[model samples]
Target: MTIPQQSGTFVLVISTGGTIACTTDPATGARTPTLSGEDLVRACGTTEEVRVFDAVSLDSSAMTLADVDTLVELAGKALGDANIAGIVITHGTDSMAETALALDLVHDDPRPVVLTGAQLPADHPSADGPANLNRAISLAADPLARGQGVMVTFGGDTFAARALIKRDTAERRAFALTAPLTVPRPAPAARAALAGIDVPILRAWPGADASLVDHVVAAGPDGIVVEALGSGNVSTAMGEALGRALDAGIPVVVSTSVPFGEVSFDYGGAGGGASLGARGALPSGWLRAGQARIALATALATGTDPRLLLGV
Candidate 1:
């Protein structure tokens, strides 16, 4: 699986824990994502042509926005180095899509930042980790992927960071594009999304309230997407703030804070899911909250209407 190492291309493979690094105990058969970067790289068998950098290692699910910023800074610095060609990040599938979008926003460099991971661990014979890594490495090393923004390579597909959403948990084919996701999309659509969606969550207050919304709006948010709790329930105060944002012509999208379920406006009344809707906060409906944010950001970045993508 060795590629002819390019003369000057340096590929940085950041290993954030996932099935790609995981191994199962023969006795228990329980799954885990804890393999090392060097081990995973050796398993992938790369040639001497491309130099590999084993970057920081951690679990993607437990990752924070701060981690994203740090990674972006590292990537920016790496790209600044004349020897580096591109970068590859092996992240947990759980929040891989989120990290990809965040990285895409922060790193303005055209060098490819490809994210890859598996639903199964490296120990499994049929595990998809090796292949996914190989593909990511190749794509990361490709000049065409440069200036294309961050990407997620899995199941033999190369997805734009802005268009991608991790839609599955245990399946190998998890990341997919938004509606009418192009078969082979290019940089324009990707950049269009990156412009506005790049707004990172600097901090979040637990109880939803207008103060927070005011704070966010005053900070000059083109739009704000709330990662609300179950069924889109936020504090009544938060709901009021949301309504204010809507009244002020600010677009607010509500997505479930829960990671694994469809966001339903089932809280009935009083600024619950339905109330949020009545207040003009668009419900994510089917899109995962994080992915929904990315789509909204991309739309805002390109001056494309968020309602158009939301179809609300």
Candidate 2:
């Protein structure tokens, strides 16, 4: 699909690398990122004079928070460039939401940043990268997307970055966020050093013990997030260990493993969110474990109260 060009408007295409840019090795059948930013823009078949920049070439699973810093740093340059209307980033879907949220934290500009990618590699017979790339470029070039903060456009749908969730492994329409998630204010920024710190996640399960929690706490991690049971409840053993971690001044956040509900301080026992809340544990309002870990890390990196990061 060819996107109509605006009179003088242009969008910057930033390629990081993912399945959208991958080529399969015939010998080993291993897929690797091989396409550059210009390569992707060239395949769009549009007359629009889109600018391209190659950022990195790694799978999202191997992506680090420090890598997100580089994206923000590059985007910052566009803030002063009047020629660019918006920015579109081609990224791996695995950790796209995490990196999008991280980028949103420091995205002080009004121009929207749109993220998109495909489930199939570029070499596949039914590869969806070309279509997804064109759609992303169209959205980025549109004046309507301005001031909407970070967003993802995939499979013909557009969603605010905060609401994006990748649910299907290989489905063409895996991303499902029908509505925009608005924040009263922009996400607070963090210290440069803290973005690279390590934060681990623990899950609460049937007859779960404190060994994992104890070991993680003993290591003195930067912070921790618990994937609790219903309504954010945990086993007594795990809760006690988490409480100890809190006492040690490590920020602890409780999030439910359930995919559809928000976590709350609804119970009163030692394993309950209420009990944990009383002991300085914070509830991850609507964030699941994945995004919670990223937000918790950002909170620990800054002087702001971590509670503010949970509500998004």
Candidate 2 residue pairs that clash: none
Model 1 lDDT-worst window of ten: 184-193
lDDT per residue, candidate 1, 98-192, as tens digits? 77866765557778889998887788879898889889988987887887778899988888775457767777788776545532332233333
Task: Provide the overall lDDT of each model, using Cα atoms, as 2-decimal numbers.
Answer: 0.69, 0.80
Q: Which stretches of candidate 2 lie over 4 Å from their true place?
A: 1-8, 177-194
**Candidate 2 residue-wise lDDT, 213-243, digit = tens:** 9999888898999989998899998888888
TM-score of 2: 0.91
**Reference-based lDDT, residue 125, model 2:** 92
Name the runs in model 1 displaced over 4 angstroms: 1-7, 52-55, 182-252, 255-287, 292-312
